[model samples]
Target: MGSQSSSFSLRIWRAARDMVVAWGRIGYLGAVVGVLLLSPSTYRGHALRPILRRMYRDTAPILLGFTLLAALICLVITRIVVVTALSYGLSRYALEMVIRVLVLELIPLTAALFVAMRCTIPNATELALMRQSGEWAAREQRGEALIRAEVLPRVVAGLYASVTLAALSCVVALVTAYLGVYGFTWAGLPGYTRMFGQVFNPSVTLLFVLKTWLFGLAVAIIPVSTGLYARPTHHDIRPGGELSGLARMFAVLLLIELTSLMGNYY
Candidate 1:
């Protein structure tokens, strides 16, 4: 019993340590964003335009497909919730509540879940396969851009996909909220913007941005690292190793959402 508890504690500690390192890397990305932008001598558009363009080039179809699917799912869910609330004679506040719960909570969670389903496992699996096949070792020994090719691009691309999709999804949810509550009316604009302002205060926005970035990082890093941690014989990898990484990824994402929610409301 004591050994089991000790082992569990160690796993928890390792997961925490990995999250710390990931956040540290994200902070470094933020710092580099300035250098990346300053060289163009033009702030008319984001200096990160080309990066985003590259991201769109690589993942636009997948991103759009994800967005459409999420919109459809959330639309149904929101309709059910709103219709049920109306049946309870709470229609007046249904819009507010939906925006809060669906827009602020479910949509983001859905986005993360979608990314996990789409990217995390495959990235982790591929990295594990590569590690098993000695690709990492070959690149390392050959003095090649292992970090650039294997790590950074995946990291950047995943972040771009997550962030873009989350932002777009939130916008979609907001618009859906308006149409759900006050169908086809411009007068709803004021109320919509006001409630949006309430929900999307600067602090909330910061948390949203930070959370999306974390989601992106989690979706990218945990699996790759876990893949790297696998035994030399890829097919011989202990099932538990991949499961452990996925468990940590979900845990970190939940912790982040909890912390951000508390930050905004508490």
Candidate 2:
């Protein structure tokens, strides 16, 4: 019993330690982003150019698919909100409810998770495999700029993808909300504009923009950081490679989402 207890405690300690170290690495990645952002030369040459093209090819189809999904979801939710508002005799507030719930909250979170699952996980897995194969050791020995030349583009691409998806979906949701509420007529445009202005006041608008930016950053940074920090040793490769990074990424995403929820609602 004593030995079993000791083993369990040891495992807990190691897990905690790993999480701390992973977060420390993510902080370093943040710093790298800052430095790269300030350095004009980081965007020069063919290094980042090709990456942009490649990322577009990789992410465009998935983003298009998600936009359609967002449209369908927005339509369904808008119908429900409008119907419920009418049932409660709050029909005038239907558009407000749609903008507040669907546009301000759900779309951005869904887009971030979608990009993280579709793009970041695979990127992290490839990076881990490279790490396991000793691809980075030689570069490190040569003092190559791993963060600037290689990883920076991936991070930038992921962030761009997140923003694109969120913005596109939000637009789609707004249009769907209008049509769902007012149909294919411009007769209700003035009322719709008034409700839009009401729901998206100064504070709420600021919070919405801030929340979307944070979601993009989280989706971009967490997986790459996890991949970079994963152990390259054979014994740890199979178990710890993708699973640990994914688990950590999801936790951080949830934290960002919950904090945004509290800030917007409370």
Question: Candidate 2: TM-score?
Answer: 0.91
* Highest lDDT against the true fold, candidate: 2
lDDT of 1 at 86: 84
**Candidate 2: which stretches are off by over 4 Å?**
139-143, 233-241
Instruction: Give lDDT: candidate 1, residue 180.
Output: 64
| TM-score of every candidate | 0.75, 0.91
Clashing pairs in model 2, backbone N/Cα/C closer than 3 A: none
lDDT by residue for model 1 (164-183), tens: 77888988877776776678
lDDT of 1: 0.68
lDDT of 2 by residue, 53-122 (tens): 7579557879779989999999999999899989999998788878988998899999998988787666
CA lDDT, candidate 2, residue 238: 37
Per-candidate Cα lDDT values, in order, are: 0.68, 0.82
